[model samples]
Target: MNDTVPPPEVIYVDTHKVACNGGGGALGHPLVYIELGAEGTAECGYCDRKFVHKDHAHEYHDPSPRPEGEH
Candidate 1:
């Protein structure tokens, strides 16, 4: 069986700046603020969650549904 883990979740935003807390609550990680690069993309250091600018979000095809309350 393949042991590789699937990629972390991806979230799209309209702005270059965003904050992540691994979804908050008991399962959450520490809060972190990230700024997307000129390419309009960034990844959370703690959770590895990808943040993509809305304009570029379409470039990636994420079959998974977005989490509730995420942009």
Candidate 2:
């Protein structure tokens, strides 16, 4: 596993779906992330905002179901 510390990184995923703070609301849910690169640098990273730590974000799935023909 990677041993790293968290930092304040910039994230803009077009929509709040990746919003860490409660769906772009004032709550601020801080997108999930994992350290990449040599250390705590942009060299490499996994942030939920950019499809990183996708599993973590899936902790709570949307209660609503998909459309009749959708999965």
Overall lDDT per candidate, in order of appearance: 0.83, 0.35
**Clash pairs detected, candidate 1:** none
lDDT of 2 at 9: 41
How well is each residue in 1-71 modelled by candidate 2, as lDDT tens digits? 75644333433232223324324456455555334222212212333222223334434233343567663
On TM-score, the candidate that comes out on top is: 1
Q: All candidates: CA RMSD in angstroms? A: 4.5, 11.9
Off by over 4 Å in 1: 1-6, 61-71
- For all predicted structures, in order, the TM-scores are 0.70, 0.19
Give lDDT tens digits, candidate 1, residues 9-57.
8777999999999999998899889999988888888888888899987
Clashing pairs in 2: 20-29, 20-30, 21-28, 21-29
